[model samples]
Target: MFVSKLFGGRASDTFITRNSGLISHLIPGDQVLADRGFTITDVLPPGVTLAIPAFTRGCKELPEHEVTRTRRLANVRIHVERAIRRLKGFKILSNIIPGRIQHVDDIVTICAGLCNLQPQLIREEIEGKASDLDEDEHIDEQQEGDEYSWDMAEDIEGNHLF
Candidate 1:
């Protein structure tokens, strides 16, 4: 969520609140792929098939397909994070704006839409190079595990912590 804010991605306190009046555009079984900010609710249409890392906290045993789909969704979600990081490369998105917090939402969405219109900033060419990885991208990764591919290095202590 931090990377999204830094990259001009939308920031509503509750995603469900922000998505209010927006979910109407989507149909049933749309394969919703979202971050953990979204609450799992039965109110959503049946067969929607939400693909998010299950953070049910000590809940025993999930369906095999849920685990498999979550993994696949995780891989694809990286590109979205990359896109947000690319947006944050611009300075306007980095700074916090005063006045309306509501405007912040608009700014983020506008910047994202604008970013979509722009060309690729970081071309995927050579390997063995740094990635435009965002800090928020690994939140889910860390939710399940203390480690992540997105970790830059040690945290405070020099013990190679994630």
Candidate 2:
């Protein structure tokens, strides 16, 4: 899914142009979920569906319905974000890659391949204590004047006590 290499200064929308060959794999029935910066819906393949969050255009808050929709979109979008985060975990992609670096493409590809061989960035099912809020429960108990509580512990909101 990695697309073409372009200058870092160029807008991502610029890469969606017909000459960029980035959308060659897209077909009429394809569905594209993209961020707001990708405003190239008109250039998409015919019948393609593009899902993006609503824009506020300077308004302080989006409508409640738009907010809900945006939250849902963000939930799905998190997976893509996590994938990119994992890719960036590799030292090569974590930093600015110089254009003159030797075999830079190969390095990226190898890092991505290595990442794929590892466990998934996220799992569908929750398991054991990882899924439980045991620490929060312990904190709640400690808040009830327990002997184990410190004399000057701050609350979760950072409210300090003398």
- In lDDT terms, which candidate is top? 2
Q: Model 1 — which ten-residue stretch has the worst lDDT?
A: 153-162
**Per-candidate clash tally:** 0, 0
After superposition, the stretches of candidate 2 with alpha carbons farther than 4 Å from their true spots are 1-3, 11-13, 16-20, 57-64, 94-100, 125-162
Q: Give the per-residue lDDT of model 1 (tens digit) for 1-162.
A: 221332234655346433454444435534455568566454456644444566546778767756544544454455455555655666665776666565776777676676655544323331112222332333232221112222212111111110
lDDT of 2: 0.49
Q: What does candidate 2's lDDT look like per residue over 1-162, in tens digits?
A: 343444445555536444556566565555566667766677777766676778898999899877655555454454455555566767666664577366666777677676566554333232112213232232111112122211121212222211
- lDDT, candidate 1, equals 0.44
lDDT (C-alpha, whole model) for all candidates: 0.44, 0.49
lDDT of 2 at 80: 53
